[model samples]
Target chain A: MSSHPLDTALKLAPSASAAGHYTGQSSPAYWNMVGPFGGTTAATLLEAVLRHPDLLGEPLSLTVNYAGAVSAGEFEVQAQPVRTNRSTQHWVITQLQKDADGQPVVCTTATAVTAARRETWSVSDAPMPQVPPPEEVPRLDLARAVEWINRYEMRPVAGVIPQQWDGSGDSSLSQLWMRDQPPRPLDFCALAAMADIFFPRVWLRRATRVPAGTVSITTYFHVGLAELAATGPGYLLGQARAQEFRNGFFDQTAQLWNQAGQLLVSTHQVVYFKE
Target chain B: MSSHPLDTALKLAPSASAAGHYTGQSSPAYWNMVGPFGGTTAATLLEAVLRHPDLLGEPLSLTVNYAGAVSAGEFEVQAQPVRTNRSTQHWVITQLQKDADGQPVVCTTATAVTAARRETWSVSDAPMPQVPPPEEVPRLDLARAVEWINRYEMRPVAGVIPQQWDGSGDSSLSQLWMRDQPPRPLDFCALAAMADIFFPRVWLRRATRVPAGTVSITTYFHVGLAELAATGPGYLLGQARAQEFRNGFFDQTAQLWNQAGQLLVSTHQVVYFKE
Candidate 1:
């Protein structure tokens, strides 16, 4: 598949970076070899793209098929303009990581079905969720190296961030004010990472402390809408439902809506339990 | 990883069968090499799982990752009992197919999360979408000779079936009386396949002449309760929202609910298109 000149050129291009520290790029430890699942890696890569200005304003559908087991490695976003449209652009973004062969492993080659931003007729007229603002909500730092979470500065509007070893059970539902540290413009990829983080908040809504469940989430991104720039105190309401929790695995569904009350993105996760 | 003595035995057990007449295999046409965006074959495999009796109670969350680009051969699923509760059973299903070694490819595994039927608790409900009775809807026999749709019978309430292919781009909503020709216990797997088929019906609703849409559906399966059995007429309501569509890919959410108004299952799908 890589036997073309463009492929060679694409391979040699420098990696894209968001440059602005607004979007936090968390520590490397969390992304390497810790979890065997591909979802974590995909989420991490999405952040990398979100920070990179070159990849902004594009809609991407990242279908990360767990291609066997992937090893611990660093990844970069390599997107190139193949065609541009008045309203849309077709481009490719590849997750580049060195395979065991010392050769690069294209963890994923996604075709971003991007388009030029259009004036949305949506007024986002709905009121924010009837919850306390972040200034009122207590802030608690997690013990884990905030690799991905580091990019987005999150202030809980309701509860504290649970530690990895925290035995205290918390409600599955959570409200928070999330913003890039430097206030960078968020892209489609960033919205995905935001949606992915909501399931934990939902878990907090239920119990005081929960046995962190392992669930596989598959997201189908439809439209490209930036959330970081949405009007308001700049927070998206995220709510999750512990839909089913039987067997050793449970499923959770989460939805993210901007301040104006339009559904921005939704996510579904299936988790494995420890107990 | 095969640590238990029963591991090998579990691996050898034949996968449970659904309602289809053919039990052991699927056509190679839906192979990824045939098309990275190939979806119908996967749809058929899903159909077989739906009809398989042993898989009846087991819940399904099938995510066709990477548009399933490389189909070396049929990826088959076989189940193993993990745990059983008074209310629900826990089953983990392993999908088997050949790897590049011509050896078995270790496809992703999914565990069914089902809750046991319980006494009445706090109740919240959503009314079933209103539509014509199943007997009033038209039929579409879009089954392939070697494929799977023929395994069951569908009676659409508002429009014609795909087999008829009467071109009409009207609405993307329809109701149906769907059941196996030889009736079987309605279960989670069946509901999954129903969600799969009903998705196309949404497009069918808009078909004034022929269904005109090419798509790759992304779906999220909700925990299903066998709530439909009590319906006197036993007809099912399948509804879909063309949630969002842009840049050639669109997403629609679908569900299968019984006549009693009990919600059976919820599904979300993202389909890609050009033609």
Candidate 2:
């Protein structure tokens, strides 16, 4: 077994006869205050589709919904390709586990689209923000209250966690340089988890650490395997911000760029918050 | 039967026996060059859930994936609430239509979350762009080649459909004031359709009218039904821009605000483009 915590966390064993069903376990290495880190869960779902025998091409888009809280233990994941076109494929994935009554319950639901990409007219209209390189920026050592926070090394460029939770925060923008703590190779699964690496926008926007969790997150992958492989284990520049917060909910959008300035993934998430 | 095009397009009749199944027909009033307008299709799926007897609260987030080209004529939708909590519910929806072989095939898949929202600490960090009021801006008369273009009234504030196709355009930002024509009151369904009002960013960015369509879209509702109802039948300020375009796929983020500058809806979409 690989020693990487992420690898162990994402390990899945295929069902004996079922084509698309696999069982996996939650990793304590990536545990959050409530449950497993959502990023890791999202990555694990994508991992299932990537490992599926019927997968058509590289992943282009993924949307995952946290239907309910997942309990620690073994869980079953179903990644079935519902539609397969000449150049694209669509998949619906579900993560289910048993409840106290031993009845199977869904904890997460997701949809992903993979496509055989072709070279096209490409442009980077949203330029990488000019910022200090990761080497120059000092690494932020957040209080390791959450186990997941210790898995990634983050260099905060701005919008660090509020020192004074006095609700004086005026902006929700946060920019940071982040990568796996042990520096694993950059891949789809790693990128997916990294997309959700930033702290919840609500916490930063209000500077009030109220209860918050991601309800739904959608990520669009701009590059394919070749581009990602070329990136290796480099640090990714991540920037996130919230547009509006109202009625106990807010949405945040984020972008991740490689050190070479290639935009890798763009993600948007809606989060439930309690004031 | 309702005479309003939107109402007609969204009309659904419950299945005789199935709890979450409904049957509906496509309307020519909202037809595009290829198939029915995607936005209307998305709203129709949401409508099924809203009309479902087991529905819990107003919509908070919706993610729709266009799995295949939906054929015209009768289509069936299934909106199943997978999990319902005290304050939130998670739903999975699918749209299917009979293929040429008379076999039902999936065309679109969607997931939605509805919640009973409570008053909370709210703020609009992303302010609505200042622009001329709808009364001050003249309505744009698009060459109505596509039938759906005539369904709404649009006034371009910036980045109108490019006048030249010579690839001289530099940016992919579009700001406009738009609303349903014949003046219909704004609702979740109307807001859902309007979220996709902007032209694909590729056309405006490269000034090359390439074939493009949205593959997946996710919309987050920051306000509840009461806030939407208060807006009445007024023009919404809509602005959209693409952050990155690469390898035949690009993502765009948009925001819709009421006339009062209250952010009503925020949406993100990934589009497939051909060179």
TM-score per prediction, in order, is 0.52, 0.99
Candidate 1 chain B lowest-lDDT run of ten: B4-13
Q: After superposition, how far is residue A69 of candidate 2 from its true place, in Å?
A: 1.6
DockQ of 2: 0.86
Provide all candidates' interface root-mean-square deviations: 9.7, 0.7
| Model 2 clashing residue pairs (backbone) | none
Against the hidden true structure, what lDDT does model 2 obtain? 0.92
Query: Which regions in candidate 2 have their CA more than 4 angstroms from the true location?
Result: none
Question: DockQ score for model 1, please?
Answer: 0.09
Q: Give the range of the ten consecutive residues with the poorest summed lDDT in model 2 chain B.
A: B136-145
